[model samples]
Target: MTAPHVESDQVRTLFSRAMSEMYRAEVPQYGTLVELVDDTNRETLQRHNELRASLERSGDLDRLGVERHGAIRLGSAEELFNSRRVFAVMGMYPVGYYDLSVANVPVHATAFRPIADEALRRNPFRVFTSLLRLELIEDEALRSEAARILAARRIFTPRALELVGIFETEGGLTRQQAEEFVHEALETFRWHGDAKVSLDVYQKLHDAHRLIADVVSFKGPHINHLTPRTLDIDAVQAAMPKRGVTPKAVIEGPPRRNCAILLRQTSFKALDEPIIFTQANAGTHTARFGEIEQRGVALTPKGRALYDKLLGSVRRHVGAEGIGPNAGDYGAELAERFKAFPDDWAELRAQGLAFFRYSATPAGIEASKRRALPSTVDGLIAGGFLHADPIVYEDFLPVSAAGIFQSNLGTDEQQNYTGRSNRAAFEAALGAEVHDEFAMYAQAEQTSLEQALVRLGSPHVARKAIA
Candidate 1:
C-alpha cells in the first residue's frame, strides 16, 4: 500500500510540530525557557501599563514578543530556490539574505527572515539558509572532490519541485489545495531517500558533510539559530547553566541607565549527536555527530557610535580617495573598518568626541570627567537616567555562528582559506536579498512606538507621556 499523502499546509504544520517535538525531546529545558519568557512578559505588562500598551499595538505576538525565528543554510541553489516554493505554501515569504562567508569566523552561513505574522503566530517557524566557504579549504583536490559530490547530491526531490512550481503559479490555492500542497512539500523536504551506500562511502559523505552539516541537517535552507529577545537575557543566562542549558559568552550591547540594548550571545558549548559512519569492514559504525559551539559579543553605545562613525568616515574618506561617486566605496570602507575594529569598543570609547557617556549625577557632566562611573544597569538607573529599556538583539552573530559550525565540524578541514564568499551569494542562492538586520529590528521597535501613539489617540500625548 502507498503511504497516505498529506497537503502542503498540513505538511508545514506537521513539520513545525515535529521540529518543536525534536527540540523539546533533545533539550527539554527549551520548553521551560519558552514558559519563562511568557511569564516574564506577563509580569512586565502588569507592572508597566505603558510598556504593555506599546507592545500590544505593535501587532506582534503578545507575551511571545515579536516573532520567534530560526535560520539554517543549504549547500546548493536548487535547494535554496525550491525551498522558497515550499515555504510559500505555508504562507512564509522570504524576507532577507545573510552571507557568512566574509564573516570573521570559520564557517560560512546565511539567513532568511520570515514575513507572515499569522503563520508565525500559528507556529514560529525557522528560516534555514546555507553558505559556501571557498576559503576554508587549502587543498584544491579536496575542494574539487567535495564540490562534485555536493553538485551530484540532489537536495530536493522532483515532487518537491513540482509542488513549488504549482504554488508559485497559483500564488495560493484554496484551503483544500493549500492543505494538499503543504503536505506534499513537507514530505518532500523531510523524506530521507533510500539510496544505499557502502560503509566507506557513507563515512566519507558524512565527513564531507560536516564541512557544512551545521547548514544542512536542519530542514531550512541552512542552519539558522532562532533567537528570542528578552529584556532579562542576563537573568536567563545566569539561570540557564544550572538548568542544563550551557551559557555561551554574553555580549553586552549599549549600556543604558536602566537596561542594556543588544546583548550578543552564543550557546556555552556545542553538543554532539551520533551519526552513522562507514568502517574498513564496509559495515556501518556510529560516530559522534560533532559538537556545536556558540559565542557572544556585546556592542556598547560607544561601539554603535563608532560603527556609525566608521561608516560616515569611510564614506568621506572614500569620496576623498576617489574610489566611487556613489556610496559603494563608503560601504566597502565601512566593512573594512568593521573588520579591523571588530572588538575595539574600548578604543572607540576613548575617542570622546565620537562616543561619550553622560554622567548620572545632578551635575549632568560627562562620566569620563568624573572619578566614578556607573557600570551596572541598576547603577545607571540609580543615577537618574530613566534606564532605557533593552532592545532585543534580533539578528545573527557571525562569529558565534561560525564558531558553532567550527565546533560541530572541524574548521581545519576546509580546503580554501582565501577568496571569501560575499553576501551576494546568499542572496542569489535564496533568491531573497538580506537587508540590514539591525535596521529591520529598529524599524520593528519604531513601529511599536508608532502604534502606541495611535492607541493613545494622539501622537503628541503619547510622545509626552512616553517620554
Candidate 2:
C-alpha cells in the first residue's frame, strides 16, 4: 500500500510549532511575550464580541493562536536561493518586495508565506527573509571581505540540501522525511554563539552597520525575531512593561482605529547576547527580539494612497521624530489625521478602499431562490443576502518593518544609501519571482465572491446581477 501523503500545510504547521518551541527555549522572554499576547487576545475576544464573531465566521479563529512570522537576514544569494527551496516544503512562497534601503536600511526583503485560502487557514506561518546588498557597502575592501567570508561559510547543513533536492524531485516528503527535514531546516535558523570572523573584521562590519555584521559574522542566518499576532497591540504595548518586556516607544504603522487597516507592530528591544569570536575573544551582539503585530484589512491601492497621504501629514505635524517624548501626542495626531479614512467596513468596500471576502448568508441563500433577489453586491449586502468580511492583511509594510528594525538596531543605525530598489537582483537571489500581494488580495476577494455566487446558485441564474 502506498504511504499516505502528508499535506504541505500539515508539515508547515508542524515546523511552525517546532520553531516556536525552539525559539521559546532559546529566548525565554519570548515565552512571556507569547503568554501576554494570548492573554490579550483572549481579553479582546471577550471584550469585543463582534470582532470575535467576525473572526469565527471567516475561519480566522482557529489559526489565531498558531499564526506567527519570523525574520532572518541572509548574507548571500546562494543561502537565500536554498532557503526558497526549504520553505517550499512548508508551502511558503515569497510575496511582495520590501526595499529597506529607501528607509536607510541596507536590506531588501520578501515575505515567504502561504498564499492559498485553505493553506493560510491551516497555518499562516511566514518568514520575512532579507538579502544583504554587499554592493551597497561604500568600502570596496570591506565589501569584498564580507563576500569572501560569506562565500566560505555554508549556512545550510549537507542533509538539509539533500532533503531539499529530494523534495524538489519527489514533489513531497514522506512523514519520516518531513520530520527529518524540519530538524535540518531548523538548523539553518538556529543561533550560533561562535562567530566565524575575527573580532577586527566583525568590528569593521559592525562599524559599517550593525546589521551587516549580524548577517556576515554568523554561521547561518539566525532567526532575528519571531512575531506573534495580537488582537490589541496598544494593550500589549501598554502591558509589556508590566510583564518585564520593554516595548518600543511608539507602535509602528497606523494608529488604532475602530476598523483597523494595514499592520500595526511593536516589539521589545533587541537583547544584548554574548558571543565568542574566532580568536576565542568574547563580545556582545544585538539582534534577537520579541515582536507583536495586530493585522488589519488589506487595503486597495486607492486606500493605500489615502493612508500614505494621511501618514505623511501626521509626520509633517509631528516632525521626523518617531515614538519617544512626543509619542503620545504623535498618536493623537495620527488618530486625528486618519479621520479622513473610512472606519466602517461597508464604507471601505463601497469606496473600493479595501478587499473583502464575500460569503452567502443563510438569508442570502434563501433570498437567491426568490424572484426579487437583489442584483448588485451592495444591494444584496443591504438586503441581508450577503455578508462581506474584511480580508485580513497577511503581509508586512516596508516602512513599519524598517521602523521596527531601526528601533531595535538603534536610532543612530540609520545610514544614507542611494540605491532605492533592486527587485530583479533580489529575485535572482531568491530563485523565483515574488508574487504580487495586491493582485493576490484581489484574486482572493474575487474567488470568494464567485464561490459565494456558485453556492447561492448557477453563475448565470443566481441573482440576476450579483456582484
Candidate 3:
C-alpha cells in the first residue's frame, strides 16, 4: 500500500522544531534567548489583556511560540538553486528580493517562507538565505581563489540531494521519507569546525569581506542564526545583559512605536569558535549568533514610502552631527521623527497606509442576515457588519537586516561596494523568480475583503469595494 501524503505544513513544523533543537544544542545561548523570549511573552500577555485579546482574535496566539526565522549564507548559485528545491518540500517559496550589496554587505538575499495563511499559522518558519557575491571582491586573484574554493565544496549531502529529487518526482513525501529528509537536510546547517581552506586563503577572503570568508571557508553553510519572535523586544534587549547575553549597542530598526511597523531586531554577539583549517592550523571564526525580532503590521506602498523618507531623514540628521557613542541620542531622534506616523489602526486603514484583513465577527455575521445591509465597506463597518484587523508584517526590512549583520560582523568588517542591485543575476542563479511580497499582501487583503462580503451575502458590494 502507498503511504498517505503528509501535509507540507506538518513537515515544515517538524523541520522548524528540529532546527531549533539542533541550534539549541550547537549554541546553548540560543536556548537561553528562547527562554527569555518565552518569559517576556508570558509577561506581555499577562500585563496587557488587550494585546492578548488582539492576538487571539487575529489567530496569532497559537503560532507565537512556534514562529521562528533563521538565516544562512550560501557560497554558490548551485547551492542556492538546489536549496530552493529543498525548501520547497517543506512548502516554503522565495519571497522579497533583498540586496544587501546596496548596504555594502556584498551579498544578495531572498526570504524563503510559507505563503498560505494556514501554513503560516501552523508554523511561520522563515530563512533569510543570502548568496555571496565573489565578484564584489576588488582583488581579482583573491576573488578567483574564493570562487574556486566555493565551487569545490558541495554543501548538500548525497542523501539530501536524493531526497529532494524524490520529493520533486513525487508530489509529497511519505512520513518515513520526510523524517529521513529532515535528518539529512539538517546536516547542511550543522557546524563543521574544519575549514576547507588554509589559514592564508581564509585570511584573503576575510580581508575582502568577512561574510565572503564565512561563506567560502566553511565546509557547508551553517545556520548563522535562528531568530525567535518576541512580543516585546525592548524587554528582551533590556534583559539580555542580565541573562549573561550582551546585545548590540542599538536595536536595529525603528525606535519604539505604539503600533510597531516592519521589524525590530536585536542580537547577541557572534560566538568566536575555534576551527581547524586544511593544514590542521587552528584559528577562530565568528558567525553564529542569537537574534530576536518583533514584527508589526505590514505597510502599504504609501506607508512604506513615508517610513523610508522619515528613516532617511533621521539618518541624515544623525549623520551630519555624527551619532553619539551611546546610540540613545539616535534612538531619540528616530522616535521624534516617527511621530508623523499615525498610531491608530483605524486612522491607518482610513488613510490606506497599511494592509488589513476583513472578516465578519459573530455579531457582524448575525447583523448581515438582516434585510437592510450597507453597500460600502465603511458603512458595513459602521453598521457592525464587518471588521478590519491589521495584517501582521510577515516580511523583513533590508536596512534593519544589514544593521543586524553589521553589528554582529563588526563595524570594521564593512566594505564599500558600488550600489549594485542585480535582481536578474540573483534570480538567474535561483532558477526561479521570487514572489513579490507587496503583491502577496495585496492579494491577501483583497481576498479577505471578498470573503467578508461573501459572508455578508453581498457579492455586489465586494465588487464595488474592491473596485
lDDT of 1 by residue, 366-448 (tens): 44245343443234435543122223333454433443444334333433332365656556766775555444544443454
Position 344, candidate 3: lDDT: 85
lDDT of 3 by residue, 1-467 (tens): 99987888888888989999999999999999999999999999999997887788678899999899999999889999999999999999999999886566888999999998878888999999999887788998888888888889998889989988988888889999999999999999999999999999888887777888899998899999999999999999999999999998778777787887888999998999999999889999989999999999899888999898988787667741123343457778888999999888878888888888888777777766785787888888878778787788998887788877877776445467648888999999999999988888888889988988888888788342221
Which 10 consecutive residues of model 1 have the lowest summed lDDT?
Answer: 286-295
lDDT of 2 at 62: 96
Q: Residue by residue across 1-467, what tens digits does model 2's lDDT show?
A: 75666788988988999999999999999999999999999999999998998898889999999999999999889988988988999999999999988667899999999999989988999999999999889999999999999999888889988988888888888898888989988998998899999999999999999889999998999898889999999999999999888888789899898999999999999998999999899999998999999999999988989998998787667743364445558878988888889999988987889999888889878776775566676677888877899999999987788888888876556577736699999999988999999999988888788888777763543332212
TM-score of each: 0.59, 0.96, 0.96
Candidate 2, residue 240: how far the Cα is off, in Å: 1.1
RMSD of each: 12.3, 2.2, 2.0
Cα RMSD for predicted model 3: 2.0
Give the higher-lDDT candidate: 1 or 3. 3
lDDT score, candidate 3: 0.86
Kindly report the root-mean-square deviation of model 1 from the true structure over all alpha carbons: 12.3
Candidate 2 residue pairs in clash (backbone atoms < 3 Å): 375-465
- TM-score ranking of the models: 3, 2, 1
Off by over 4 Å in 2: 316-329, 458-467
